[model samples]
Target: MSRYPLRSTLFFLCPLFSGLLACFIWAATLPPAAAQERGGGQTPSLGFAPRPKESAPDKELRFLRDSTAAAAISADELLEDRERKRVIGRGFADLRFLGKRVQADHIEVQTETRDAVATGNIIFQAGNDRIVGSRIDFNLDSERLVIYDAKGYLGATYYITGNVVRRISVDRYEVIDGTFTTCEGDKPDWAFHSRKSTFQIEGYAHLQAPLLSLRGVPAAALPYAIFPIKSKRETGFLIPTIGYANRNGLEFSPRFFWAINKWSDATFGVDYYEKRGSRYLGEYRYILSKDTAGQFNTTYFKDKLEKTTLWDIKSSHISSLPGGWGFSAVTDFASRKNDDRSLERNLNDRVRQDTDTRLELTPNLKGIPGSLRVAMRRREGLRENDGDLFQKFPHITLDVSQSQIGSSEFRYSLGSSATSFYRVQNKKTTVLQRFDAAPSVSLPVQTVPWLGVTANFGLRYTYWTDQKRTPDVPGNPSRDDQKQSPLSREIWFSSLGVAGPRFSRVYNGGFGPFRDFKHILSFQTTYSYAPAMDSRDRKLIIPIDNVDAFNDQNTVSYGIVNRVLTKLKTGEGFETRQLFTASLTQSADIAEARREQNLSANPRRPFGDVVLDIQSRPISLIRFTHEAIYDPYEHEIDEQTTGLLLEGGRNWYLGLDRTWRRKRSRGRDPQSGRSDLNFSAGYGLTRRWFLEYLTRINNVQNITLQQS
Candidate 1:
């Protein structure tokens, strides 16, 4: 047993010992050799596997490999065929190239050709555009895509759907069998369907064979059309205006605008009235420079109901020239086939058609301190029964500045004019030529801050050439007579002297809403004198204007003025403003006393009417004005005018006026007077709504004369 046990034990122990020795040798030798073989004779460590030594070329190669991996396209599922250089992906595949992204349920890419195809719910996104298509074929390098059955959104306001769409560039696209609409819905409010369309980003869409549909109903068709997708100024059709008027009935006006250039534009409009006929209107606007702008408009209408043709032309222009010269012209001319009854039905239109036209040019004299104005004017009446009309074809005037007399206080000025007047009545014409000139000199003296005086002396001369008039002619006067009189001349001299004294006082810290209040009082007296010409000689002069021979008279006019000023705080800053002005004027005619021209067989009274004027702005939004002439000799009010204006909240305004004039002679009733009351109000109801009313009432008759 002992021998067997020993042998068995020895056998187990020997095998165990032999296995442990072989394991140690195998472990020690195997690790070193394997490490040498794997790491190029480098020792292995227990802390971590020894890092392989990298050379410059290896480092560069590894960096390149990592960059390539980063730029490579990734997908959830990818199937690659190396031989064909093709890749196929399914289930939520997405690819990004450039700045755009493409997503689809299934995608196929050709690596060599740099092209891709996507099907089943494909979406493409670039910039603000997101396009969805059933199938898409795109070139990766070229960034060109062809989408089938695509619907895309441009910005947020526009939508486009097409059977096929080709992306030409980032800002351009070509669509076939497409519909474009600004409205968002399955059923759009308005849409344009085109067989072929080309879109340019933020510009316009060119459509071939476009049909305009409203509420899914085809409303219009065009061979080719350009739809503006921008808010900038472009040549296009404007929205039509539709309304109904009582006089003109239903009206529809459509306009077309043409942008000629950056400085000019034109609009052509057509207005159709159901009761009346159509009207064509055209307007042209231009701006040549900063100081030059103009507009010309014309309207032509043929009324079928009234069987009349009406036309009106209006033009206005203002231009500033070099060397302090300016030009302005306004022309308003209208013509009708018939009388006022057959003219425009609206009162405003009738008034506009009867307006006058004028043109003026002002030029600065080079060496002289003056300006010259040349004007042309024309007028035509449209009333049923009107009298003769006087018109000036062209008028020229010169106004010179006041010149000093060698540092003296005396200044002189000259004003001259030449005018041609034409009078037409009952198919007859009369012409008159007149020339006038006036020169004046003034001397102003201020002895102190409260005392001032001004003396003015003037001479006026007028010459006129007119047809000779025969006295005691039994029949009507013939304006076509060839007889002419010699040029008549009238000369007059006048002098005026004014002396005044002004006084003012200021009070502070007492007035409400005003920091300082001032009161100014002034008293002035004016004395005018001229030698009268003979009455018989004055009868020979034909007056064409206001200049006439002076009457033999010595007059003294006295005026008293009171003005109130205040310094107040406003929203912007401190302001100094005038609050009210009150004035009273009266004159005494001394020459009437010397002539003894009193018809009442009483003492000759020299005192004339006393004029009272008051203008007051008591508050920021209210104004009151009163003017009256009181006859002190007769102890009566001759004339009176009063006005009140109120500007309130919510853009509301109200104005009231009262006027009264006394009759010169009392007929049966001593209190007979003519009086009128006018009331006007305007209110803004809403942002785009307004209401205005104006009415005049005759006080004596107790009736409304006019209301608008």
Candidate 2:
């Protein structure tokens, strides 16, 4: 045996094919533990097809019966009573009726009533189902039976045993001193034993005085329990949870689910903490139609320790409407301010201090796809004293998709937006309204299989109804600048990108079961030029967001992409996969070089930081990735991330990840730097033994922020 790895590569375009094929259905007798589709379907377990009238599980499970045949019976010794319409058999008697069979040592049957009584070594068989008992009473026509000391096997994977068991109806059974197991071996790995129990074949079960056992040995006992018998979603109470936390003391919660209907469901639960009172949690999900589905989750509680109320609500919705329209929305809101941590919530959510709610609608404008979006956001802990920073009360955008220009290679796209930026502090308010539009046209051409070239030209126009002096600038603005109204600005931009000249080589070592290996090297280049804005015009711009901090870019970027591909041997054939990939890119600023040349400065400004990305999956069970950004001027790796994942065997899995960012100067914000290490691993010592561990270490920024 040898290790083989599976791989995936991202491709911009690929060919797809679809064809219609003639097909037929076939019946198979699956293994004892095989799964099936129950509820009104054929069992197919007893090496036979199903009868027509047995359409619902609520009806009898019957095999195919001969239409023009008579009842058959045989025994070593037999007796008949014509007057009473009775028959008696002794010494291993056997009877066969319509889709039913029975065998016993002594048997008596009534012809008119279709009833039978068997006492010695009785065995009854139905559609893919069999039962053994000492004494049995059955109705042939109704397919109902009762037995004493019954041990039964039903469906594909279930077993039942009881002192007294009755098949009240189809899929419903009553038992006393019964046991149920789905395990496959002669001795079940686990089972549920109960004194009084009722089982529904495709639904759930209710057990009284239930005892759980592992490998036939009792492990735990519960006063009452309910278990879902099928794999599909079912309306029932979920398993209750219990645990202890340092601040919450003891915690307990039990959840109930309502199937509502085929397309919707809801789950509700109440969490009780010994020292922190109670919390209510709920979630609702629905699918109104093929194109519509949504979910909402919420949690609320009144804290006893803080004597305050807390809540968190979230929702996500996506639906397509008539008239070539599609809609989606998401919302997140919280009440009060705290860590938002409880026994029921993850501690990592404590870092959240801001939320964004957005609504969007996509339209097919004369068969062209476009989208309109409205969003609002709120932020906290942005100021030194930890007050309010800024809010986008309602930002709007409409963007049109890029499309071909009427049988030509040229393509065009349009984007427009409106936004209101507001800041609140000390009962004073600062507000600004900004509007902008940007449209671009692009041409893409591929002259050869290995070369692609694209050129783009765009114009951006912005208008502002409000303006405010930025405090960070060197000098105060004149009165005339402050009084300026309805300011607007415009700019034209262009860019070019070339991706081509892929170099590749194939090595034919013909290693064991492998055909060969292929390696590819490709280059990508992009250049953009934006004219610098004069100081007079720059002063008119409002100081908000990245758009306000725009800088002239006369820069060119170069990137090299490397990829390795290999074929793996499978039972049937060989399959190709990507074994490794790495990309490196760096940029040179021509504008900075020209500025330094006029100043006649020595040792001109160096190129921008270098970025490196690498991914390797040498074997099926191991993966590694590394990413880093290095500053050439500072001669240091300013940011880096490395991760490794492994699965040694069935029970030996592990992962490690490290991320760090460096702040080069002391004046930089302390919170801008981070060094975090995360590790998680779990292993099974044996079938009955296991070990697991996980941890995270944050080595920077000791600030404590609050949220609710």
TM-score of 1: 0.58
lDDT of 1 by residue, 440-535 (tens): 888888878888877778777766776346433212235645235745444445555554588899987647766788999999888887666555
**Poorest stretch of ten by lDDT in candidate 2:** 16-25
> What lDDT does candidate 1 reach at residue 142?
65
Q: Which ten residues in a row have the lowest lDDT in candidate 1?
A: 1-10
**For each candidate, what is the lDDT?**
0.68, 0.68
Residue-wise C-alpha lDDT for candidate 2, range 206-268, written one tens digit per residue = 778777665567766766666444434566555445556556777777677777878888888
Q: CA lDDT of 356 in candidate 2?
A: 46
Q: Tell me each candidate's TM-score.
A: 0.58, 0.66
Given candidate 2, what's the lDDT at residue 243? 55
Q: After superposition, how far is residue 383 of candidate 1 from its true place, in Å?
A: 2.0
